[model samples]
Target: MRVSIKDIALKCNLSVSTVSRALNGDYGVKSATRTSVMKVAKELGYVPNIAAKELVSQKSKLIGIILNESDGDGEARPAFFELLPHINKTLAIFNYRAIIYTINSNSYIRGEITDIINLRNLSGCIVVSVFRENHPIYEDIKSLNNPIVVLESSILTRICSNINTDEVMGGYMATRYLIDNGHKQIGFVNGPQNFEISNERFEGFQKAIEESQLQISDTAIIWSNYTGSGGKDSIHQLIQNNPAITAVFFANDLMAMGAISSMAESGILVPKDISIIGYDGLFVCKYYNPPLASVVIDNAAIGVRAAELLLELINGGSGKTVRVMPKLFEGKSVRKY
Candidate 1:
């Protein structure tokens, strides 16, 4: 009961071969004839056989999207989740479908990534995960022929194409924001080792410290996971190390919430005895008891842009790097000093 190209050909009074060429916009067909065929095809609501087209073109019209989960946890930062909707939005405009490749792996093996990528007949791939400066997988990806766009990678010289936010600047912004408000004894909670974003943000913290000429002894910094529980633990350690510390800057909002709750349990009030600032402008931050001040990074934009960048490589975009910057949000948590 459905319509076919042959049926359209018969209705248009054209040979089947000619109709096929016109529908495909083949070189031999005249523009006028092609337009006429397309007109009829539209009027008939003709849906071309995509499988047949793939056979002829040998292209899947599918792009590979790699989700590189960091921190060895199933939890993806709220910003990373934001990127997914934007990537889907951008791909919709290009008529290209995404083939998700999960890199929720802790092995850090090149073969794992290579095997997963080859399993799908993808025209191109976009790698989204937090990797360090000397990861072996970077070399392996560079050896492959497929176009790749890596997200949140700091080492641009080795990779073909990459897109990431200015994390160091983000770190600097968060720390400086605290410093600008006249808080001299500022405390900082650091993230785990080897993740590039952590290091960059750490550098930014140092930059602010350097500019202020503030002496941050070893006791002022406590390294921990970017989770709320980690933040809660780090606060105890930080306070134990430097009891006089009056303000704290948590690398992520999860830790900030933990610190806020723990402080309240012990008869401490935010910005009264201590001020707190956090990162990742998640929507949930707005509802906190004393709304959290944070660094606003557009995770959705990163996701969407990363997708578009991969598409360009598939359809013929030159290799290049993209960067996004983070901004600050002034919430109720920070008190004016």
Candidate 2:
């Protein structure tokens, strides 16, 4: 019951080849003829078959991806869950399909990326792994002919496009907010060691603390993996080291949530006993018993922009290094100190 290009051509009384070329916006089709073909195509409700088009074009029309898949049934991070849809939706706009290549952190091996990419015939690739420094795939990634876009904080390789926020600025903003809030004993809960985002954010935190001349104890800064268990486990060590700390800036929202929950379980109330501000503005933050204040980056925007950059690279363009800024969202968790 669907209308076809042949139907449009028949109605317009034009050759099938001429109708096809005009519909595709190919050269050699007259403007008047192209317009007529479109008018007829629209009238007939003719939809271009993407699958058929791709077959003829001899391109996969599929965007390849590498995402971290947990080995166990542990909960996924909020960032990955939210980011997947935005990437798919953005790719849909360009009539492209997304093909996920999930990998466990331990399973990533050298030359594996190249093998899969070539086998899939991917038009381009996006690496969504939340990485630590010197990601293992660096060399193999460089050897691929396909374009790559990484969500890493640094330009780890020459061939890939990297997109990340100014984590240092984010850290600065959070710390300065605490200082301006009349809280002198501000604490910081950092992410795992060697994470570029975590290090940058910590650097910014240090800058603000030094500028404010605020006293910081070794116990006040906690190093945590960007996970709930990590956050929960880290807080006791921190509080035992610096019992007088008032406000804490968490590197990511997930850890913040865990810290707050752990604090509550230990009979401490948020903002009353301590104030917490988290990075990564997840939607679930709003529903927290007391909404969590956070630094919100445009993760959705980052995904789309990375896709755009990769597509450009696929079309013979060079990758450019870019950084996006984040904004602070004031939620109910932070009290006026």
Poorest lDDT segment (10 consecutive residues) of candidate 2: 68-77
Cα lDDT tens digits for candidate 1, 84-166: 77877776554567777776446767677677666766666777666555777777777766767887774343325788888
**Candidate 2 Cα outliers beyond 4 Å, as residue runs:** 1-57, 71-73, 156-159
> What value does the lDDT take at residue 26 in candidate 2?
46
**In order, what lDDT does every prediction score?**
0.78, 0.80
TM-score list, all predictions: 0.83, 0.84
Q: Which ranges of candidate 1 are over 4 A from the true structure?
A: 1-41, 69-74, 155-159
User: How do the residues 211-326 of candidate 2 rate in per-residue lDDT, one tens digit apiece?
Assistant: 98888987788888888877777777778777888888999888889889999999999979888888988988889868998888888888888877776676567778888999
Backbone clashes counted, model 2: 0
TM-score of 2: 0.84
